[model samples]
Target: METTSSVADIQMVTFLLGSEEYGVDVMDVREIVDITDVTKVANAPSHVEGVIDLRGSIVPIVSLKKRFGLPEAAAGDYNCIAVMDFAGALTGFVIDEVTDVIRVARRDILPPLELGSEPWMEGILSLGPRLIVVMNLKHLA
Candidate 1:
C-alpha cells in the first residue's frame, strides 16, 4: 500500500469586511450561510453578535467588523455568516461578503508588518492589485 500525504498549500476563503479584504484558512471554515436571526446573549462580549441555532447545534456568532474596530453596519442582503471551527468549538463570523476561494503557495504569504501588533492577522498576501489579510481564527475565539 502506498500511503501519500496531501501537501499543505495555502488555501483561504476570502471575504470582505467594509472596504478591506480578509481571508481565513479553508480548513477552519465549515460553511457559509446567509445572515439569519441571532438570539442575543446577555453579558456577552461586545464583539459577540449572538448565538444561532444551526441545525440543532448552537453556534455563537461574532461581528468581525466590531472585532476589527470598524463601524457597525446594519445587516444587508450581502451579509453572511462564515461558520468556522475554532479550537474544537464552532463559531460564526458575520462578514459583508464572501469573495472566493484562493489557492496560493505558502512561500507567497508575507509576514505582517511590525507596527501596532494585530494578533488576529496571520499574514498578508499580494494578489495583483489587491492585498488580502490572512487571519488567525484561533485569536478571534
Candidate 2:
C-alpha cells in the first residue's frame, strides 16, 4: 500500500461566504477573477449557475451559497469567482470577498467532524481569532 505524505503546513486563500469564512489550498487556485459573462446551462443543478469562457476553455461555475443552502445574497451583491483546479478540471466557485492568504500549520487544523458538517470539508482551521472552514473539493468533484 502506498502511504500518503502528510502536509506539515499549507497556504490557503480565504474568502467569505455569508458570514462564515472558508478556505481552499492556494495551490488548487488557478486565479481569482470578477464574475461576469456566465453563460447559463439548461437542465443543470441549481448550485451550478453556468459556464464561463475562461480565455479559451469553458469552465463551469458553482455557487458555494446554493451548494451549502445558504440564503441568497442581496441583489447586486459583490462577488468574486475563485477559479480552482478540482481533481483536474478548472471550476469556479463564487465567494463574497477574498479575506487573506494564510499559512496554516497541521497542528491548527482540527479533523472534520462527521456530524453537522459537509463531507467536502477537509478540516476546520482554528488560528488566533479566525476560524475557517477548509474545503477539500476534490472529493466532491
Candidate 3:
C-alpha cells in the first residue's frame, strides 16, 4: 500500500489560535471535541489549563495561548480541544477554531530556517495570499 511517506504530500489539520493559522499532521490528532469543563490541577505547569474527564480517561489540557504567552481569546469566542498524541503522551490542547484538513505538497512547504530560529514552527506553507504555519506539536508536549 502506498503511504504518506511514499507520497509527495502531507495531510494537515488546520486550526486557529489568536488570529494565526496553524496546522499539524492530521495522523497525530485523535479527535476534536467541543470545549468542556476542565478541573484545575494545583501546582501544575503554568501553560496547563487543567484536566478533563474524557469518557473514563483523564486528559490534561493545555492552553496554546498560555503556552505561547499570547492574549486569551475574548469572551464568547468558540473554542475546541484538539486531542493529539505528542511527546509520547496523549494531550488535549485548546484551540480557537478548526479551519480545514488540507493536503500540503512537499514543494509547497518551506523550511522554518528561512524564518530563522522558531523552535515551535515546523514548516511554512503558503496557500494563495494566506500563509499557514505548520507547527511542531512535539514541542507542546
Candidate 4:
C-alpha cells in the first residue's frame, strides 16, 4: 500500500469542513474573511446563499455544504468565507474554519479510487498522516 506523506508536500490551503480536512490550490484562493451578514437575493439558485458587499462590488456567496449535498454547518461558531476568483467570476465559499497553508507536491497526489458509491470528490492528496480530499470549487460555482 502506498503511504500518505506529510502535509508539507501539498501546495495548498487546508481548511476544515466539519471534521474532514479539505484543500484547494493556493493560487485559486484570493483571501479569507470572517463570516458576515449576507444580503439575500430573490429568485437566486438554491445553492447560492446570497451576496456580500466585498469592498465596492457585490460578491456572490455559495454554501459549499449545500453544493456538495453535505449537512449545513451550525452557526455561532468558527466560520469563514474563502473568496476566490475563477473564470472571471468572484465567489465566496463558507467553510467551518481556516486551517493552514501547506505545500503538497503533485507527486504526492493520488488518483481517485473506484469506490462503489463515492460522492463528487475531486481527488485524494497526501497531507501528513491522512489523505485530504481535494474539492473542485469550480464545479461548485
Strongest candidate by lDDT: 2
The weakest ten consecutive residues by lDDT in model 3 span: 112-121
Off by over 4 Å in 2: 1-7
Estimate, for each residue in 100-134, the C-alpha lDDT of model 2 and write its tens digit.
Answer: 99876777889888788767888999877888999
What C-alpha lDDT do the candidate models reach, one value each?
Answer: 0.87, 0.88, 0.86, 0.78
- Model 3 lDDT per residue over 1-141, tens place: 786564788899999998889899998899999998899999999989899999988999998888877899775564899999878778999999999999878788898865454687888889997788899877654
Positional deviation of 124 in candidate 3, in angstroms?
Answer: 0.9
Candidate 1 residues 76-102, lDDT tens each? Answer: 644789999987899998989988998
| All candidates in order of lDDT, best leading | 2, 1, 3, 4
Per-residue CA lDDT of candidate 4, range 26-86, in tens?
8889999899998999999888899999998799998877776787876666489999875
Candidate 4 versus the native: TM-score?
A: 0.82
Tally clashes: model 2. 0
- Models 1 onward score TM values of 0.90, 0.90, 0.88, 0.82
1 against 4, candidate with superior TM-score: 1
